[model samples]
Target: MSLHEDAVLVLKAYEGRDEQQRALREVYLEHLAEHPDAMYKPCGAGHVTGSALVIDPEGGRVLLTLHKKLGLWLQMGGHCEPGDATLAGAAMREAVEESGIASGLTLLEGGPVRLDRHPIPAPCNWHLDVQYAALAPAGAVAEISEESLDLRWFAYEEVAAVADTSVVELLEATRARLGA
Candidate 1:
């Protein structure tokens, strides 16, 4: 099946634990149904982007990058590429690429942690982010990529003070999934 079809199935099967997630799932489904290119970045209206929060559960810390262009502390994520076969695959790809952890990084199971819709510069009006959390193996070391100005691990409690609300929410949902 195509990535678009996979996204539809994933969203439909997503049993959102909250009203907001359920609402956003519908919006994503509608967007995908209306625009076949919604999985690509060139979509004029908006597009689906995949993101993964890098979490070191044992260390009780989360990895966040200072985005090169946006200059904000955020999770590793970006536009979908042609090679991406599924939304979760795209999320995992971005996570590994941005985090520079070549191996042992695993995505949290049970699908996406959350969905966030945020406005962006023109050409593309919005980024409909499907967020997931990746479990970083112990002793994993991260190197900053061209897309980031800096990369570092922050204690779970420090996330809110540094990252925007969306990142914090993703972390909370991830932690809930982790049962921490």
Candidate 2:
């Protein structure tokens, strides 16, 4: 199936209450089972595209986007697109597009260094997120878009204190995975 088709399926999966969504997810999982490499190994409800934890090098801060749809601060990411051959590459592209950072950004080798699975709330199934680490200099300026109401950098500790529990957990996991 085309990437857009896959995205549609995913969107449908996420649009329902938690229990209802789980049923829809089983259908997607059955589809994914046919194409193992195009998705990920151990493919199931949790297997989806990856996300990135972007860090500003100078101030030791992290970049976060206020997701328009979810109204929550989240890492820049989504399902992989057709142009992307790997989950990591799709994550890098999403980061650049969502953050509007023009400067060259590089992924930390051996990252997104963490992987985990979480439910997408009700009406939508679940996404198995593969998380990576990306580092950029502190001087980088972000250009916001409709996808986010705002984008900013926060000190790691400060971010942990303020961000939602799930985000905080991801941040902590990224730090531990990257030893940063």
Candidate 3:
């Protein structure tokens, strides 16, 4: 099946635990139904992006990359590629690629932790971000990729100081999921 079909199924099966998430899920479904090209990057107006907040198992820190283009400390994520089978797969692939951890990365048990719709540069107006949480195994080492100016693990408290509001929100949602 195509990524679009897979995304439809994933979204349909997901049961949001909160009213805000439930509303966001509906919006995402509606957006997907309205735009068949929503899963691809070249949609022109905007498109879905998959991202993961990689957390250490101890839950004290998260891996963040200083985005090369935006120059902001953010979670690891990017556009969905043709090879991506599902939104979650795209997020995992991005996490592995950006974090330089080839193995021992596991997604949180629940569905996506949050949905963030944010504006991007021209050629793409917005990124409908499906965010998930990934647990990095003990002793997992991260190497910076070309996409990032720098990559480092930040304490939960430090996230707010360094990252933008979007990243901070993602981190809060991820932490709530971990505690749940």
Clashes of each: 0, 12, 0
| Overall lDDT per candidate, in order of appearance | 0.95, 0.66, 0.88
lDDT of candidate 3 at residue 32, scale 0 to 100: 89
96 Cα displacement, candidate 3 (Å): 0.4
TM-score of every model? Answer: 0.99, 0.70, 0.94
For candidate 2, lDDT tens digit of each residue in 1-180? Answer: 554345335444343224534554555455455445335423333447667877775576889998887878877777765587555677788888888886777887753454445676544446756566677755888889778988888888888665776577667766665566
What would you estimate as the lDDT of candidate 3?
A: 0.88
Q: After superposition, how far is residue 39 of candidate 1 from its true place, in Å?
A: 0.3
Q: Pick the candidate with the highest TM-score.
A: 1
Query: Where in model 3 is the C-alpha error above 4 Å?
Result: none
lDDT for each residue of candidate 3 in 34-107, tens digit (9 for 90 to 100): 89999988887678889999999585899999999988999999999988988899999999999999999999
- Residue 75 of model 2, lDDT score: 79
lDDT, candidate 2, equals 0.66
Q: List runs of model 2 lying over 4 Å from the truth.
A: 1-47, 121-124
Number of the predicted model whose lDDT against the real structure is largest? 1
Residue 140's lDDT within candidate 1 is 96
Sort by lDDT, best first: what order?
Answer: 1, 3, 2
